[model samples]
Target: MALPSAVKVFLLTMNRSLGHVRQVEARPLPPRNELQQSVLVKTFEELFAELRQKAAERPEGSGTVAALDKGVHFIGKKVVEEAAESWMAAEHEGRERTAEEISQLLYQAQCLMIASGLDLEDVYRHL
Candidate 1:
């Protein structure tokens, strides 16, 4: 049973005795610096800070609805403004601009969730 020359070559490459072993350059793993610049983390921090402030502004367990409504309303306003910016970007600039605007819009929406006493993690978990 004669094997093809390619098979013999492949077998030789797999063998530890082969002097023609492939050299794999050991590259340093990518740094986690990108996470420091993550928009998601930044947005979460901003949203949570505002949420805490709004919570602190709460009048000692009185009128939770009012607080929630105020927060939601403010977030809704931000969303609308962001949406407008996105639309303008889409019309005037390009996809890159529009994507940036949309990212801002998502951040605003996340703020709304926080303000409304909702956890973004919960949404992520459910999804």
Candidate 2:
């Protein structure tokens, strides 16, 4: 089955942000014993900081800037769409795919939060 145009666009934007283009090849996973140690570490706090900077700077060709320029409603819709995609990926695809979708969901949700003038501290206070 073919993906929706919006999904394709989102993937393209994400790929560009990651310095990737058109096709990406999958590399073999690490040995089971090394899996835990080999995992790439990241934090939403770091991501939010970057997004906040992007919002302030509006760098050329930045996906974050593009999303912010489109305003909160568009980012909100993307967050909702990504959430559904994440659920679908978990149900139909396996762990790796689910992780990818969840990453997208988090990015979009963060974009929404930034556009709404909220930050990690605001969310943490509520939780």
**Root-mean-square deviation per candidate:** 17.2, 14.5
Q: What is the lDDT of residue 55 in candidate 2?
A: 91
TM-score of 2: 0.69
- Candidate 1 segments whose C-alpha is farther than 4 A from its true place: 1-70
After TM-score superposition, what is the CA distance of residue 92 in candidate 1 from its true location, in Å?
3.1
lDDT of 1 at 15: 30
Q: After aligning candidate 1 to the native by TM-score, how far in Å is the CA of 54 from where it should be?
A: 8.4
lDDT of each: 0.65, 0.82
> Per-residue lDDT of 4-123 in model 1, one digit per residue for the tens?
554443322333555555543333423457655653344455656655575567666644335466678776887899999997997698979997899788767766676766776767
Model 2 lDDT, residue 13, Cα:
26
On lDDT, the candidate that comes out on top is 2
Best by TM-score: 2
Candidate 1, residue 43: the lDDT equals: 47
Any residue pairs clashing in model 1, and if so which?
A: none
Q: After aligning candidate 1 to the native by TM-score, how far in Å is the CA of 75 from where it should be?
A: 1.9
